[model samples]
Target: MLTLQIYLNRITTQHNGATLDYRGQFSNSRLIVADFTQFVNDIQAALKSAAEKNIYTPPSKLFGNLRATPICLDVREQLADGLSPVEYKVLLETLMAVCNSRAVKPEQVLYHGKIPFQAA
Candidate 1:
């Protein structure tokens, strides 16, 4: 099974930054490793594109908090460095947990390459 404790630093228009925690878990039986790998690959590709563009756009309002420009810069750096399987799986689980907690489908939170912006 995979587990994640996702912290969403919500950056609303009124609040610069607000930290929130969300927890979720998925078993190996629930997640096919190949699908997870493809998902990560797609994210990697999108990160590369965002790096070239110098900005990452959020797919949904739920991720708006993580939309700060500096976060994207950091993401670009992280993407350039590359992610290991463990990191990628953790990321996948974190996102899944966040979506589950928010009652938002994972597809709704899709922003393959863009940074999930958080600001304070």
Candidate 2:
């Protein structure tokens, strides 16, 4: 569900009757060469730590791109801040992603704050 943008900008454009979009020196290329496995780990760890810390508020990455950082979510502490739909969706998806990859089932994902959501 990550909407990646890898499009090249227009090669030519005119503003003051002159081209400004195609100057190679003025433009720089950005390649988002990502490691999928590392991305997965980053997200999984973020969500897992959130649950562990009881985070519930919407995170910065929830409505945007996720990065490798220790931005935890303490749900009990964040309920006051509330969350937008986008954040909720992202949080759910993140949790599910971590759970599925770790072989933790849905029922097992919310068990009293333990890894696997709970100890079986």
User: What tens digits encode model 2's per-residue C-alpha lDDT throughout 15-113?
Assistant: 234332221121123211123344335544434443354432223545432332222221221222343344333434544554333332333222123
Q: Give a tens-digit lDDT track for model 1, residues 3-120.
A: 1121121111111242222222212332322244443444444434443454334334666435422221112122333433454445546444433333332222212344342212
lDDT of each: 0.32, 0.30
**Candidate 2: 10-residue stretch with minimal lDDT:** 1-10
Best by lDDT: 1
Per-residue error (Å), model 1, residue 107: 12
